[model samples]
Target: MSDAQFWEMNPTATEILNEVKARKIQEINAAYTAEAQPLIKEYPLVEQQSWTAQNTEARAYLAWHADQQGAAPGTPVLDNILMGRNGETGTETLQQLCLAVIENAEMFTQFQQLTGKRQRLVKAVRAAEAVEEIELISW
Candidate 1:
């Protein structure tokens, strides 16, 4: 079954699942942004801001676009940020968002893919986490 279809079919279970999924997503997002804010801020050119998962992909695209338009890839461009936020320029917001996305893509994608009612995603994340812990212990 399609992902949306699977979700729709079991609405009751999905509701609870979605809640837990959403909470996890929020926690991931919050942690990422909180950690990234200081890193981006340390670089004078990049702006520090919080982003939601729904807008991340579009934002990343915009960031890439802006960089191509003479704005430095990692630098903050006021026009790009405003245009991206307002959808004024097809390239601007997507550029800023894109850069932001690239900076946090790994964590964001994990949060996105794991967001569902199924147990597989959780199992995978836990497995990965366990592996990481083991690696760290060995180190």
Candidate 2:
């Protein structure tokens, strides 16, 4: 039912309903923040968002294709590129690359296309989130 219809059907429950909705908003925002905060600190905001978008893309691809596989999913292409570069364990290599991205920001021509894709993804995500957050605040 629509909001007006539902409210008419249960006039006495409006306060309770509002409270429940408010609590849910708080809970959802808290959950999103709790998961996002550490990564936000580690990368600049743009890179953190780029990583999230890249992860989501990779995960969706894996979900649909994993069982039909020739090879089971392994590390992401981005991780593989970094790993192959250093011959180190994945984490250290990725950390070093991320730090390099932050520090140099202009030195890696080979990675330029990959980084460009991430840059675009980050901009799009930020724009979309800005609109969503504005709407969420009205609730």
Candidate 3:
């Protein structure tokens, strides 16, 4: 059922539903920040060179591609070309070189585990899926 239908059917449970939704949003946000933000932040550093180098290299690549195509490098072509240079392969290539490097880096697994709060959240959410069930913890 749609959210509105559910709400209409169970107006009295609205407060509990809203609390669960709010908590889910908070949990997802926390997981994103903890697990994903740093990896995303490193994208520019890993994908492109420094500012000066980026500009110079991109311009050169554009000039070369334009010469070959006999037209100015359009935005899409520039993006593809730049991505190719970043990978030293076609735009659709898998296994970016940096990904392999990162995998081998001493910090990779630690970074992934620490940042991967979604795994933990998934387990918690799965357990909570049976809302009618009670869980007891032994200390």
lDDT agreement with native, every candidate? 0.48, 0.48, 0.48
The TM-score of predicted model 2 comes to 0.27
lDDT of 3 by residue, 56-106 (tens): 444554455546666543344335545767676445422242233334343
Provide the global lDDT of candidate 3 against the true structure: 0.48
The C-alpha TM-scores of every prediction are 0.26, 0.27, 0.33
Clashes of each: 11, 0, 1
| Rank order (by TM-score, best first) | 3, 2, 1
lDDT tens digits, residue span 1-139, model 2: 4567756765555454454454445554565456445434555765544664445445544454647556544546547557677575444544455454444333333445544554454444334433343234321
Candidate 2 residues lying further than 4 Å off, grouped into runs, are 1-12, 52-139
RMSDs, each prediction?
A: 14.1, 16.6, 12.4
lDDT of 1 by residue, 1-139 (tens): 4567756776675454554454454555565556556445554542333344325544644655756666444433444555667774464444455555565655645554334323443444334433333233210
Ranked by lDDT from best down, the candidates are 2, 3, 1
In candidate 3, clashing pairs total 1
Angstrom error at residue 131, model 3: 5.8
